[model samples]
Target: MLPTLRSLMRQRELALHLLTPEDALPAGALDAAIEWVHSSDLDDPTPFLSAGQVLLSTGTQFEAAPGAESVFAYVQRLRDVGVAGLGFGTEVVRAGTPDALLDACLQIGLPLFEVPYRTPFIAVARAASDMAAEERFARRSWSLGAQRAIAIAALRPDGLSASLEELSRQLGHWVALFNANGALDRVFPAGALAASQPAGPAAAAGADGLVDTVRREATRLLRRGQRASSTITAGGETLTLQTLGRREQLRGVLALGGSSELDQAGNEVVTAVIALAGLALEQNHSLDRARGQIRAAVLRALRHGDLALATSVSDGLWGELPAEPVRCAVVETRGGQLDAVTEHLEALVVEHPGRLFFAVDDGRLVLCLGEDGLPLLTELCSAFALRAGLSEPGAYSDLDRAMAQAEQALARAGDAVGVSEFGEIARDGVLSYLTTTDAGAIGRSVLQPLSEHDAAQHSELLRTLRLWLEQNGQLDATAQLLGVHRHTVRARIAQIEKLLGRDLSGFQERAELWAALLVAAE
Candidate 1:
């Protein structure tokens, strides 16, 4: 401990005289502080003394600026410059401490000591200087000891947690280590205010917002080899957050979690923790990837089939199967190439955070979306389209369909337009014939009579009848889709029925004609 002004004066039996009581001096109030500076400048004590050093001044500096600031202001200026305490001379300055200065010192938490006329300024300076030298030696010794402990922790096979715990205990803080995936792998409860499972995916607010801020900043630093510190809120309490990354191939994170900023020892522990965790994550990428893939596969299997099957494939595989009925989406890029599609897919996931099943095939992204996945997928498709022209959405499906049906629909949509045919093509071969068959042949076969009639009359009777059938005979909806009034739509349907010599209202007739419409659309 550095020698305080009151403590030193007592060693010389001077605390009794200097701290005489009527306005009794508190314990250790009269001793000369070891870390103090001589400051005669009343204008700005900052120019004279560095931060954290006590200031000693005479009344002459304040006399020059008496026109403006009071002695209170003068004391405040010195304190603002990191002055620990200030001493005033009784001989050259006011006979007694000024009430204004006294109030300022007490209010601002700055310590003030009296310099009696009989006391020599040189003696006080000499006393403080000697104590400072001794204090410096102790500080170096403590720092060296801490550094050695950290070095030893670095060499341990499993010493990261131990080193951090010890460091936090020494420095008075909390410590947590996070893996690359943002999970807390270790936590030592040195200063944590709440009891939470820190290793879980969810973390609560900590001291100075340390919990949330540390986890977030730690993950970021570990990933990019960057460092950050901030104040955060956790459990309705404020806390300090400090994050550091290791210098290794797979850098990890060390988090100093507490209500106060970490001291030097705490920082070193943070560094050591980062080194161990980062190295572990970096070295275990292959294993991590494999485990992640397995988990994903299990989740994937759960999507279309039984959970048991997904669970049986591999541990952690298929862990994230999307909830059903999964929505399918197609993405088309500029060049018709599948390359770089995965990157865009990943980016899409990041931009729209939710459950999504995205896979790249050829030049497209086939995503089996989670809840609201279709709309998100649409937005993603639009973004990809804006970036480059290779992305597009083709064939689609019903709001509900079997997994097999949805998959087929996705396939057909990838190959053609309308987005609903992957299943239709497989079910009845209609989508395939309509999309892949020679359009002229199919059109001639289905719309030949219409061509002949239109050749004679000039009307879209075939198309009109097809629209009529699609509306399920609902005059209103079909009209809306066709952008015509109900009367116009009915008339078109009537005209189409008459031209084809069939009652379009009949279910069979409607079905067969709908089939032919697909063919004609080819």
Candidate 2:
């Protein structure tokens, strides 16, 4: 800190005397910061000085302007220019300090001190300059020390968390870290206002409001899908938010909050932390990708009937494969929503490590979760508006067959936004096996003649055939459902049989056509 007016007067070597009475002192008058000291004899010296400076001058200016009003105007000009105080050199061009100057300063509330003959103006300026220089040195040293501590913190086992805590301690403020999903990953200084209740009622309310605002802002930044920083003021504190990772793929957000603004050194420390945190996130991202690749490899092995190999590879990392009689779920979402869904599932994998194991195959999210986790999978599919298929419980050795069942169910799921369980459709026995075969494609080829005839003649033969098959060849039921007469349904059915060259009298042909429609709906 720089020397104040009160401190200058306390220096014995300077021997400065306060001309203004203590009772007449203005607010913050005694502790006025003195950045520099200047001596000028001109009547107007305001142009040469800056704010937070002390002016030193002989009584020559007072000699020119001898009246009390003139002296008052001079003090007003110095005050207007934010001069910390005025120092009048006595015993030079005058016997003592002028009465008009003393009265003007006392009335205007501008601090005035008498400089004794023994103390040179140079000494006062040098003293203030030295104090300023020492402050700069102290701040720079602190910055270097803080940077060193942060760097050391970054080498710890939990480097990211440790470094953030160190940064918060050094800054004497709260720091929060969020993951790519905008979920709060960590917060420094445990039991902070953001993490725990405050002591006072007013503070408690303020803390709650601040936490909500911070979360909303963090989410908004990630949703913007850009690399940026924001400064916000809430609950009487300033908060700084910065996005980590690249603009194209944001990893997370880092937030720092405090009651005061950061100085130059504090800003430098923050910059260092951001760089370190960004590098850490990038490293973690690479590790996550490697783990995903390993998971995919394991899933491939399981599908290839290499359960032992899969178990050996994934046992330590992700816990045992969801045990025998595991159910497989295949989930898929819109193209733009893949990242959001992936982040949610990744978080779940971390939370429920042993109970669930999932891997992305092609564009779909495939999972081999325990029977107990089926309900959670169903909820996830509904929550994310994802199209999913669940296979019947099967042994780990039969994972290949189970995956085929899930794909067949998924294909039959069509464009609907929900889960399709293979068990629901598998009760038809032979139909289940037939649905998975290329028979659906062959049936579609067989029905092409009917589709073209209907499109050309704008007839209802295909619709009549589907309804007839659905109603089990009940003429009255199909006709009533179609809002047509039984005779018209009979005529359309006859035309359908002739066009497709398939005898609808048999259940095999009708089931094949129905299966074809189901597969093609996807």
Candidate 3:
């Protein structure tokens, strides 16, 4: 809030008159803070003048036939050095203001003022300095007030959201909060802030594209876990991204949009918000860990067939379990990537509002999800390339049995199939229980006689028997599948029954042959 050119002009006691037209001055130059003021008669005073200062000169050096070009060069140099404006002293050295300097100031868009001889140069400098000090003190006071307000908001019932709301008000910008996973958790000003252009179809499309780009950049910055700030131009507005947390443990990010770069006071407020947000995130994480421990205990109690204890613990943490049957799933990562899989599942669970209990046990992830969450759990497993086994839907009382079934199904899941269900394994019966070596042995033993017979006699009996079994021992259907007549199929089945010394009509024999066929195919 240092004194600006316009503010100095308003001080009648200083007798400052703007030589340059108000409209001709550079945009924001009048409102720009004047760091200090200095007087110099030396040519090329730019070396001594700093940025954001009003340079006062008596044109003493210009008395010696100073040309317009020289005046232009001097003003250009002062402008290049970021001098806030040029103040030419009148009624001394040279009467009134010279035409060359006035033209030069107008051409360069630099603010120029005339200081009457009645007003000493020291007066203007002292005034600017005093105003700057006053503004500094005011800003400091305002910053302290904002910080205290934000801190109090953080202690309110709504906590972080209230703090964010206060921050948005102080900043005059939209604020958005993102979780650790880079997902947007909340936004201040709600839906009022949108990325969009003024009008036209092309502008609309461009706005959409820019919004997507900003979101991608924000997410990337959050995941990178670096304390950084970036300005993104989107929808004709500037958006700034700021990471919240300590250097070692990045917990979340804050996105501020619809505003320009923050000033000193604004930056101080942002720092406070970042610190508070970090503490809030840390507290939330600690709470989540405690809840997870409670959930783990509940899972263990359920596994031990202690339903009442499990129910009590679960109710205390995540409310009541679903009244409907719930399915238990056991998931195992392919490459010992438990952390990645667990994070993925946890994110999915957050999206699903229903009750879910999950924890890592014995190097595998176990979950008892609500029946409605089955599809999402399945999707998460498949997306993460995790091998999973799911048990049938069962009540909380049947938790132990469901877990056992899920584990058995997980063991049955071979490399070919990524996921297996208890019902599928149960349907496979004893064949599903066989290991690779055992199934191979059983397959060779049951089919070796027919295979040898076919090899020795060059008959199609094995193929015919497989087709017949696959067709559920239907003569006409098997014949059609084999592209042969029903009579030929019947003859082949009779030869197979005689060669195996077993009646194909018996259910036990048919079951055994079917199992052998399945094992051999595998």
Q: Top lDDT: which candidate number?
A: 2
Candidate 2 lDDT tens digits, 248-311: 7888899888887787888899989999999999998887788778989999998888988998
> How many clashes would you count in candidate 3?
0
Superposed Cα deviation of residue 441, candidate 3 (Å): 12
Q: Which ten residues in a row have the lowest lDDT in candidate 1?
A: 387-396
The numbered model that scores best in TM-score is 3
Worst 10 residues of 2 by lDDT: 190-199
TM-scores of the models, in the order given: 0.45, 0.67, 0.76
Q: Cα deviation in Å at residue 364, candidate 1?
A: 15
lDDT of each prediction vs. the true structure?
Answer: 0.56, 0.83, 0.80
Could you tell me the lDDT of residue 2 within candidate 2? 64
lDDT of 3 by residue, 56-153 (tens): 99988898968889889989999999999989999889798888898999999899999999999999988888888888899889999999999999
Measured with C-alpha atoms, the lDDT of residue 141 in candidate 1 is 72
Residue runs of model 3 more than 4 Å from their true location after superposition:
191-247, 329-391, 404-466, 472-477, 485-522
| Candidate 3 accuracy as TM-score | 0.76
- Measured with C-alpha atoms, the lDDT of residue 383 in candidate 3 is 69
What's model 2's TM-score? 0.67
